[model samples]
Target: MVKAGRVLALLLLLLSFGVTAPTATADAAPVLSSVWTGTWETAPSGTAPALPGAAIRNVVHTSVGGTAVRIRLSNRFGTVPLTLGAVTVALRRAGGGPAAVAGSMRVATFSGAESVNLPPGWDVLTDPVSLAVPAAADLLVTVFTPADSGPATYHRTALQTSYVAAQGEQRAADEDGTAYSAKIHYWYYVTGVDVRGTAAGSVVAFGDSLTDGNGSTTDANHRWPDRLAERLQGRRLGVLNAGLAGNRLLRDGVGPSALARLDADALSRAGVRALIVLEGINDIKGSPEASDPVAFVEAYREIVTRAHALGIRVVGATLTPYGGYSAFTAAREAVRQKVNALIRTGGVFDAVVDLDAVVRDPASPERIRPDYDPGDHLHFNDAGMRVLADAVEPAVVG
Candidate 1:
């Protein structure tokens, strides 16, 4: 009887561990309801230098918050394998700085290890860390590379400043802001940051320079999508800006063509419920194929079909007029009109946001309103961005 009792106690202990282990794994799994993604665009050629051992800090604003967070690092454009020495995440104390708020710092690891290696053309995610992040708040991510890390993968047009330590310096693991003094207007390696929650899914704004905030004030978060995020504050939906400046719809230009990158930039995101497409202007200005609206329309239709396959609704925004821009021509203008007519005629999109109607001059029809044009006649001014954001119907997004 004594031996049997001991055996029974051991069996119960094993069961407890087994049951609790699965529960812990379940808790640590990614939350499928809500996601806040900070997308990465291409950095101009030769923008990032090789790191022989340095610490780099990037500041990214979160559109939603939750109890746990994970970060993505990439070597998508690197020709050589990239080695990450260490990584850390902390809440920023102020605007575009390296400082983290006191007591809010957390160490991030990859699969229980402190370091990771990313092969050329790949991305990796850090193990989730328990942290309370607030919506629209900024977080500082610091990375250290110990080896002669080859050409860096980066995104220019961040509009927000990021910092890098001098070559061979190892201050990246420091928790304080004093060590980072150099500044650059781009993000390196870091791709997306995600938080776990039960909020309504995310909204991805996919477009070209117009949607990328080419003319908006830097660091002001005044991009139309930024304004839309501000308006959607406290709601379950978060907005992700996937606009790549100079990106096109038909063929590759500054970055991969919109059709080529759609799966990675929009569909691969966690918990995405809707997407707002504002492409084709670049194609109209540059591509020979744009002279015929059929290719552009087919590209958009493919996007809609693929998105719907993933349960994501598509919102189509009419191409804003660019009549006075240097690239504008009467032929391109006719194509633009045809595309806009198709967008308004329905069937391709779940909803329509008439940015053309909102920003175009009512009298001229083919030109941007004077107040909305920021000298370029293509991109919107700050107030114009606000108007574009306000034009989005909230009821249709979720």
Candidate 2:
């Protein structure tokens, strides 16, 4: 028989690893909605240095307006305790960078405290700060680390530049951009932002690099989902982009597979009422078993069934042509055709978005339109991204 001492030690070990019992926040009043969510992924350690006694400013755009806002910070990939010294939120100056609009900044607290400690594999939601967050405008979330925090947790390939302070400088409360001279493309330690408002709900764009805006202009917010948010400005809906570059549907790569992270990335957001799936091209080109429509279809069906259970509507997008890519092959092209055909008529989702019909070249029918191809032949250009966004029906999202 196992000793009582051994049992106690085992329980301690599990608790150290962040295993804890669930608690209820149901009695909490004032419901808020998440207007922007960037799914967190472990940043390759050593690729970017940790912020020791420095401030990092992450610039994110909101999809809807609100009177109060809160930020979510994560240490999911850290190997040590993450200590935060100060946190602030403010409206970004028109041109971007770390600048905040004068007199618009507000201090964010955790559980009524100015600072908080986050254990490894854990995240914290800040107490709501009253700020007039405008729809489709940029917000800067600034964080200061007081000690030599180990390797940072970041989302690689943010596609928009963010600012970090030089060593020996703590600029989390700075209202100007001069204190922040260094810039990086990855967003560190921030996972999401929630707003208190009357928005109907959020729409999550779940997919791979195509949906992540690989070739779109930097700091332009021209990603298809961003354009879709712009199109949905006057409405009571929010568009949250959950795309991870090089993601797959059947197996894990850059991030967890769609099937694995669906619950956390797509369904966990605040007020999510719909999901748009546009993945599987990476699986077609990367995984041997994924070349068949059967496996891809099965995964899609599972995603639909799970979303439907939560009363969330699901929309499947037809995979676009990728003929000129280096890894393209006749077999993979055939698989794409079969999968697109299924998405168009399989009735696996509540509705369908015919992306293939909107962006394919008429002459070849198997290649992206010449003007839409951004030299990669796989991802779309800015104009193409807008076209893809324009094709999404507002009525369907509502």
Candidate 3:
């Protein structure tokens, strides 16, 4: 009875001082409903001459849906500042001529400002904008540059054609896209798009031309990663394609070396949970080829080590056959076989997907299956891309 009286007295004293007692649930903070995850991404493979005063509409495909979206733009190779007069994002119209769906466009901002500048070597993500993003849907990210900028960082083989307005035109806000009559094969400035939603995470497909969809139809989205995205639609995990055509593992070719760009293109991407590395073929065939199996194995081990440090599961894919490629030689073939043998036994990855085994012709073990080859032995056709996606172990990514 005395202890109860003391508790009452304390409460009364607090009331007298005008400090109300806190309620258990009411005083607690509200929980956030969604987390950010990467839905689509592309690495900048090289630089291009700037399009002064032009508005560019980059068409990107999504791997997952979300209530809101954000974009990443890079000037990682620029020589001067990238002045963005305005940036906007919208769902591509049904018929799609760079036009946006009505009432779906949203202006993007940085630090709450509609306009911002990115200097050389700069990489930034736009502030999130509310929009109903759907899986497999196309988005048109429009950027208007009111003045001349530096060499524009670009992904040379987007496989998807985007649009660009005439110089000195500011059509980023134009809904009809009539001003965006000119088309470009490259994805300029933009690098990635992240969505805020209930996603498990994302898988990064990091590699070279084989992964970059070099032989896939333009705007068809038939890249292996794109096919993988379709397979992962209901899994709530985004698939990011970090491939660069002609890219090498040991040295730069179409883009920075695999090791050099891994961090920016795969490791540090939004909500990365797994990594699919399909590189090394270029290194084995390109000039100053890294033919030594030891060198290649060491590089693969290094990749595994780096990815494991961040708790990312790494899946190593054996190099696909390229027998009929102009660059093929007996010595190179031996090196490829040696590397694949080591990769199958190295124990350097969390998992392994034998792309060579799946795509190689049984009759000519060193060559790709004819049905899968897209005339170029080094690249795959749409059907082959589907095979690559199906080869991945779903449990590994999950």
Best by lDDT: 3
Candidate 2 per-residue lDDT, tens place, 319-398, comes to 99998898889988999999999999888988999999999999998899999999999999899999999999988776
Better of 1 and 3 by TM-score: 3
Q: Candidate 3's residue-wise lDDT over 1-398, tens digit each?
A: 56998988865653342222111111112129777888999989889988888899999999998999988888888888788888899999987679899999899988677887775776767777999999999999988888878788888999888999885355787888888889998998888899988988899999998888988788889999999998888788899999998898888888789988888888887788899999999888889887799988888888889888878899989988999999998899999999988888888888889999999999998898999998978899998999999999788786
lDDT of 2 at 308: 85
Query: Which ranges of candidate 3 are over 4 A from the true structure?
Result: 1-31, 167-170
Give each model a TM-score: 0.88, 0.89, 0.91
- lDDT of prediction 1: 0.77
Regions of candidate 2 where Cα sits further than 4 Å from its true position:
1-48, 168-170, 287-289
Q: How accurate is candidate 2 locally (lDDT)?
A: 0.79
**Least accurate 10 contiguous residues by lDDT in model 1:** 18-27
Q: How does candidate 3 score on lDDT?
A: 0.85
Q: How many clashes (backbone atoms < 3 Å, residues ≥3 apart in a chain or on different chains) does model 3 have?
A: 0
The lDDT of each candidate is 0.77, 0.79, 0.85
Clashes of each: 0, 0, 0
